[model samples]
Target: MSDSNTTDFTNPSTFILLGIPGLERAHVWISIPFCTMYTIAILGNFTILFTVKTDLSLHGPMYYFLCMLAITDLVVSTSILPKMLAIYWFNSREIDFSACLTQMYFIHCFSVMESGIFVAMALDRYVAICDPLRHSTILTNSVVAKIGLAVMLRSSLLALPFPFLASQWPYCRTNIIPQQYCIHMAMVKLACTDTRASSYYGLFVVFCVIGLDVFFIAVSYTQILRAIFSLSTKDARLKTFGTCSSHLCAILAFYIPCLFSALTHRFGHNVPLHFHVLIANVYLLMPPMLNPIIYGVRTKQIRDRLLRLFTHKGT
Candidate 1:
């Protein structure tokens, strides 16, 4: 171990990741669930991608947005799970500085992309239910592509400063990160220099990305509700609402855990470190695992297609 008080102001070549910190004894046992969730996440997301790609019935704006969500989920989960599993299973906790920064970048970047996709999906739902006549024309292939490109650019640009800022700091402090992966704040806290700029910028990005996304989603849903309630028949309202059930489930699955993790990290001072670690892991893994199942169960078209697929394979 390098001396913590060394005079060197240069960044460390490698950082030690203490997976789950205080629960080191339970690392092996804990890895079982993480590994399971990761496997399920991978298979579930790929299934969504393949099912959408091959099915002509699903070739719509909504399904295209779903494909984007699945891809984002895959990237988000893949960015952190392998390294986290390694820490738990083999005790391989040393991460190269540049690799750590890259992991941090992907994890955060795709997460924002995921949030943006949810907002797009919400708007797609709003248009579908509220303006069924113009839905097809409004969210055309060109428009969808543009939205995708914009989301990618927004996420990439917003996330760039996290790693860039981290790289500039001199890590005279210990390079031991308490979490399983290199979180932005975790890495920033290791710097010997002041990190308020990074901290405030992080807050800015959170409110700018997540807060704005949430507001838009709420507005979209509000409009959707007004449209639904304006319908004359109860059956019509129920039918319309059922279409949005899957999306609502997905949004809750993502944002709830995400907010919990962030709040716990920033404000839950009384919370145990292991609990924080576990919630953080859950925040990353849960959405990827749940999204496909949520859609499969709630969406009649997808459910029917999946059933046909399984029955065909069984024959």
Candidate 2:
């Protein structure tokens, strides 16, 4: 048992993050790829944001949602990468109690927000391809704004419980977290009090947010596919399906690792802790780094705008 005098029963003063427990010797080497991914994520997402903002032709509801996605990806990565890099590079592993909770909140909150944005983007594509004439009228600026607000509110409110639940628990156990960052379950595990409620509620929130979002996206894609198939010409069908390819890539990049991480966390009892931590980091980093690349390469208008910008800069 931890000595009462040293341990803060209410909540510890700080938590020590063991950056990839099994890979301690490789921390420096690991920091190299993490830093590269983070730099790419920052530059790529910012490019997306800048290109979307400056180009009026690209200011459709689709791009607006893309901007929202870029911002969400930025937050999701920024929330943890710096601290993680610090842990790896500088041996700065200690994070304040309140700050840890805040980081945990931001990571989970923005992850849910990203999923919601995927649903919004899927709906945008569905309307665009399935009902082209009404797409503009359906996803007006005001409506898009409202949707963005709704996503924010939904993610924020649902994730609010995480930090609150974590903060209230008594941490008489060790303050050392096995992962590079403070995850909800990682923090909860340190609490001496009953944690079943936290665990179950977390699963509930996952279902309510991510599960619902995935279902909606799947439905949207189903209708989209049907619409594509209904097109009489083979060329028309391919063309329409091509429009969704980038978004589909983005969705896969974000969700595949995300779901795997979630499942591993909840059920993969035999999975290595380091592997779980790596997956969690990849889930956060990969989408941010890849989304802009996928969109820039796949979307013509944004690609042209980016080319012109770079050409102008070169001249």
Report, for every candidate in turn, its global Cα lDDT versus the true structure. 0.92, 0.91
When summed lDDT is taken over every stretch of 10 residues in candidate 1, the lowest stretch is 2-11
Model 2 over residues 230-287: C-alpha lDDT tens digits? 9999999998898999999999998899888989999999999899999988988999
How does model 1 score by TM-score? 0.97
Clashing pairs in 2: none
- lDDT over C-alpha atoms for residue 84 of model 1: 90
Candidate 1 has an lDDT of: 0.92
lDDT of 1 at 3: 73
What's the count of clashing pairs in each model shown?
0, 0
